[model samples]
Target: MNLFSEIRGLVLDALAQMQSDGALPEGLSFVNVAVEPPRDAAHGDMATNAAMVLAKPAKMKPRDIADVLAGKLATDERITSAEVAGPGFLNLRLAPAVWQGVLAAVLEKDTDYGRSAMGQGQKVNVEYVSANPTGPLHVGHTRGAVFGDALASLLAYSGHDVTREYYINDGGAQVDVLARSAYERYREANGLSPEIAEGLYPGDYLIPIGEALKEKYGDSLIDKPESEWLEELREFSTEAMMDLIRADLKALGVEMDVFFSEKSLYGTGRIEAALKSLTDKGLIYEGVLEPPKGKKPEDWEPREQTLFKSTEHGDDVDRPVKKSDGSWTYFAPDIAYHYDKVTRGFDALIDVFGADHGGYVKRMKAAVSALSDGTVSLDIKLTQLVKLWKNGEPFKMSKRAGNFVTLRDVVDQVGPDVTRFVMLTRKNDAPLDFDFDKVLEQSRENPVFYVQYAHARVMSVLRRAAEAGIAADDATLTEADLGKIDHASELTVAKKLAEWPRLVEIAARTNEPHRVAFYLYELAGDFHALWNKGNDETQLRFIQDGDVATSQSKIALARAVSVVISAGLGILGVTPAQEMR
Candidate 1:
């Protein structure tokens, strides 16, 4: 149950009455009207802009409208008071039983409590961690992977049919580089002391690909020329790189629903089809783009070529689809890739890219918009850089991923759960510091442990209640007499618990999984505060020594906290610890 929505219904009902009674205009639209919790808790449970939004439209003063709406809202049984706040805002105070009922609702729904229908099962394609299939995934890709996967999960929980996709850059020069790199390793496996050229991949990861190539071809490709073995090696090397990438993602508990290859677009006429649609719409033309401001390339001579009029759709300039030499530009395949996604029947698309790909966002969004006739919405989230820290110093780099730390390196040090949770502790656009020393800490400073500890504490209570022969199953606990839970501290936790459903919708609406992490932190802090309060007041303790009825009622609250924590962690793809280790 969305309490905010329930209260919004009340506001609109009041406005309808005002219109019926002729106190307001006969034809006023409430599209801009909104009801939400005020920034400060003391302002009220929810505040509405009924007056502010309608004042000018109705040709009436805001206070005049708010005063009339307040009187109508006061008759709502759920609202204890309706007051006109500054400049026509209607602040509402719901009855204490309303908050109490919300907690009971959470207990009723259990793990499914916060699941939403906000998305209405819309099809959304989330493309993330589309790293070059040239080496193992690095730490930077880890953040994008976690954020994108969690976002896909969040969207699904909010009722969207989401497809987690990874676009493989397998059609470009990079795959050719992979083939050449593996050739060097293949020669090394033959004990030839192969020379590692300047442009070749020098990482030890290619050693396995070389060995695998041997096992498959058995030295048949050993003495072949570039043209003879390039295609075969490119295909083989890319598959091995993707295998390592998939394994790295699985280690961090990430999985994709689709792996789209750029190579497929090369021979499939998909690029021509996508650009043809644009050309039919007059979005494709032959043009020369202006040199970039202040730092034009030395070869900035104007040459007419096939270009997409991306500037009309907000790109900095018209983008080339084909170079003067007739080969497709790098962006040509990407546009076709996203066009392929749009044609797959997604109602919306979300691409999670590294911050370095920020310059590409506008053109990509433009492509999807053009391809889908502006019907499909594309939300591109760029995850910022991740700086690693260990033992109070910057974490060392990985030879596997060339210049950066690999995902396996991070997951190996702190395990998958910690790595995933820590990566999402910041917004996708906000740079994050992954400290190997801090994330493994058992204290509240570590969010993964803090949230997990709260779940473990609740489990501890349940185990104790079970050992004492107190029936604390959800069915029994839901029926417990919570009338005795009038303690201010206990009720404080109930208020926090009531925010779960609201928080989920908020996080999903914004595509911000970091909000979930922050919410869990706050929720755990509040639960911890209540637990610490039991030290001072004997009656505040969950177990009242010999009273099973009162203890069951109190333990019911603790059990509900665990239920919510477990569900929230589940959304984050983190397993709640049954006990602290």
Candidate 2:
């Protein structure tokens, strides 16, 4: 079903023939050979570099190799023409029937048309949106959540067993700060003027937490000192904040498969166990770290500490696991968390972190490498910032989230479909400017609208055909007179459809789901172009006036576009629009 892969196989078969004929040396590696779409569509459907890649290795001129390869390829019935272009590249154009088969395959496969097995069912753990459970998720966390969820879906579609997970940061000072802030709210609920400390959270979202605390503890915790209630309130308040966060993610259509707690790593020997695994390998030591670069020696003080030899793996310097005061540094729990993941037997690990955590990437990768003993691979994707705009002006912050916009706020304004699609319009590493005005517009300038409009247009065609008493179902379309679909405009859409399976594998390999969005936009553009051509040429229209056979064939092509679009949108976690409002 993958025309490019099929063509590549033909090219390999031709090379093997050349080896058998003794026209080329035996046992030459063809791994570098590739068959891909030509840079310019007018040149050919696909271009191969087999001849060029094997020229020097086979001790022959590239043009000579291309000439023989082209002759061998031209013998195949599927390949109508194989011409040499440039230095040694072979351009191929497949028969119209071959493109027709692609459309029929689409009808047969439906949403699974572009699904790939490139991942080979490898077990992958994707950890994202591990925000501190202090309040509702904000705009920054929204981007990570969307990206990670979409990535997990993409990997799953490509045959990877993906686990979506979140790491709760409750075992930190931030949770204590949240407890103190809620305690102030509790005092306010008790009819007392509360002290709003400078560092305490000031958001009004915690008012309900305060009222709930009053209902449960009622005056028992009211008069107690800090030591008497801090721990209890910390546990209670973190659970409340996590519930709020879960609701926020649910609004955005995100569901985590696992929610791991940082507190669990404490009160257990997990941290010691992870470090001991490294220490047994001579990676742990006690030493004084050199003063950081670009700082004066007098301004920096070096202290002896327990460190991990992260440099042995890939980090720029050794990292501290325990401070001079003997408390675990932040890196200790992180190492333990990754060690736990490796011990769980996942083949790969992917962490989606905010761009601010860019500095931690190297150390984290080093820790995973050391823990897994190079048996597991870790890929950390850092989602950059998202700047919101409305009416060509900077969007103001939300009072509910205190100083930032909450994910719920964005979803409430534009709904989850638009929110998810617009967030992924850019790559994870690039900063995105999400304009509320532009995203809601119905024009083609909006990618989400354009893609959805294409799907809706296909639905309209099917409905019109149905009303006209023409059978447009897949069962009928699969046996339709597809030879009637010989127009250049119709074949152009089929060509685009042929690229879907290839694009899916490419996107999955690069771990970039934005490529799917981009491809969907391009496919929509091609479909829209074909739709517009029908306005002038009655034969190009999908619904023929009196010919059911031709109408079925054309409608089949349009439906195929929708099938791929729906699959791509599904990977992005965006619902397809059945009709545009």
TM-score for each model = 0.97, 0.99
Q: In candidate 2, which residue ranges exceed 4 Å CA deviation?
A: 297-299
Shift in Å, residue 324, candidate 1: 0.4
lDDT tens digits by residue: candidate 1, 1-581:
87777778888888999999999988899988888868887887788998999999899999999999999989878888999988889898877777667667878899898889999999999999999999889889999999999898898999999999999999889889889999888887876676788888889999988888778877777777899989999999999899999999999899998999989998889999999999999999987777788898987888889999887777777789999999999999999998888888999999998898889988987888899889999999999999999888999888776777899999999998898889889998999998898998999899989998999999898999989999989999888888877787887788788788888999999999988889889889989999999988889888889999999988988888888888888888898889997
Least lDDT summed over 10 consecutive residues: which range in candidate 2? 293-302
* Candidate 2 TM-score versus the reference: 0.99
At residue 572, candidate 2 shows an lDDT of 97
Q: Pick the candidate with the highest TM-score.
A: 2
Q: List the residue pairs that clash in candidate 2.
A: none
